[model samples]
Target chain A: EAGVAQSPRYKIIEKRQSVAFWCNPISGHATLYWYQQILGQGPKLLIQFQNNGVVDDSQLPKDRFSAERLKGVDSTLKIQPAKLEDSAVYLCASSPTGRGALAKNIQYFGAGTRLSVL
Target chain B: SQQGEEDPQALSIQEGENATMNCSYKTSINNLQWYRQNSGRGLVHLILIRSNEREKHSGRLRVTLDTSKKSSSLLITASRAADTASYFCATDAARGSNYKLTFGKGTLLTVNP
Candidate 1:
C-alpha cells in the first residue's frame, strides 16, 4: 500500500503571509494527525482527527492555525499571518484507529512539508 | 508538553559496532515507540514496546523499557552506513482523550562505513 502523502516538499513564505499544506493519508486509515517539528526539536501535535471529527487540537494556535478533515481521507492545515516561529516542518500521519493492541497507536508519517518564513 | 527526551543529541559510530540511544519520559505511558528518519524524509516506525513488556527485538534492533524508571533504550547491532539517520522515541501518555504520541528531540546517528 502507498504511504501517507504530503504536498509541496518545501515551501518558502514571508512573515505575515498565509500558507497551507495538504495531506492524503493511507487508504482505509481512520485517524489523521498534523504535527509541527521545529529544527532540533521533536514533533508537536497540532491537531488530530478520527474520521471527520476532531479528537484533539488543544496545542493548536487557534488565532493563526486551523485544520480540517472533511471526508476523513484527506486533510489540510493552514496558517495565516505566519510568523518566523512558524518556520518548521509540518508532518502528517495516520493510523487505522486508536484502540486495541493491533492498531492502537502506530502512526505512519509522511515526508513532511518544510516551511521557511523569511 | 513533550513526553520523551532522548539523550546524546548526536552520536557517531563505525560499521559493525553497536549503537545505543536512550530516552526518558515524564508521565505514565501506555506504550513507547521508536522511529527512524533519513535526512529530509519522513519517519519510519521501528518498534513499539508496551508498558507491560520489558524488552523486544526485531532483527538487529533491540528495545528495552523500564517503567519503574520511566526510561527506554534502543540498540542497533552491527550498524551499517544505511543506519545513519535520526532516531526518535515517542510515548503514548495516559492523559488526554486519545493516544497521541509525544516525541523526543531525537538522536542523530552517523554510522560510517
Candidate 2:
C-alpha cells in the first residue's frame, strides 16, 4: 500500500499571502487530518475529516485556515492571508476508519509541507 | 491544549545502549501510542498500549502504560544510530473517538555510533 502523499515539499510566502497544500491518503482510508507543527512543538490537530464530512475543526484557526476532503479520498488545506506566526510544517495524516480500535491505533502521515512566511 | 509532557526533552547516548523516555498525561485515555519522526518530517507509528494493557513489545521497542498513574514509558533496547529521532507519546482521550490523538512535545534522542 502506498503511504500518504503530499505535494510541494516546501513553500515560501509573505505575510498576508495565501497558500494551499494537497494530500492523498492511503487507499480505502476514511478519515483525514490536518496538523500544524511549530519548529519545536508537536503536531497540533487543526482539523479532522471522517470521510467527506468534518468530524472536528475546533482548533482550525478558521479565520484563515480551512480544509476539505472530497469524495472521501483526497484532502486540501488552505491558509489565507497567512501570518508570520503561521510559518510551520503542515502535516496530513489518515486513518483506516474514524471508529474502531484498529483505526485509532495507527495514523499514516505525509512528508509534510514546510511553509516559510517572510 | 497538549495532553502530555515528555521528560528529558533531549538525550544523547552511544549505539548499542538502551534509551528510555517517559510521558505524563492529564486526562483519562483509552490508549497511548508512540511515534517516531526524523528530521521533523512525517511521523512513523512505533507502538500502542491499551488502557488495560500494562506493557507491549515490538521488535526492539517496549512500551508500558500505567492508567493508575496516568503515565507511560518507551524503551528501546540495543538501539542503533538509526534510532536517533524524536519520539512522541500520543493519548486518545476517553471522551472522544480513538482517532483524536493528543500528542506531547516529544523527546529528541541522539544515538551516536
Cα lDDT for residue B32, model 2?
Answer: 91
In model 2, the Cα lDDT at residue A62 comes to 92
Once fitted onto the true fold, the runs of candidate 1 whose alpha carbons sit more than 4 angstroms away are B95-97
TM-score of chain A of 1: 0.96
Residue-level lDDT of model 1, residues A14-63, one tens digit each, is: 99999999999999889899999999888999999999999999999999
Computed on C-alphas against the true complex, the DockQ of each candidate is 0.90, 0.73
What is candidate 2's lDDT per residue for B1-113, written digit by digit as tens?
99989987999999999999999999999889999999958999999888999999999999999899999999999999999999999988887663789899999999999
lDDT of 2 by residue, A41-111 (tens): 88999999988999899999999988888898999999998999999999999988546765655889999
Model 1, span B18-112: residue lDDT tens: 99999999999888999999989989999999899999999999999999999999999999999999999999886563868899999999999
Off by over 4 Å in 2: A98-100
| Least well predicted 10-residue stretch by lDDT in candidate 2 chain A | A97-106
- Residue A25 of model 1 has an lDDT of 97
C-alpha lDDT (0 to 100) for residue A105 of candidate 2: 56
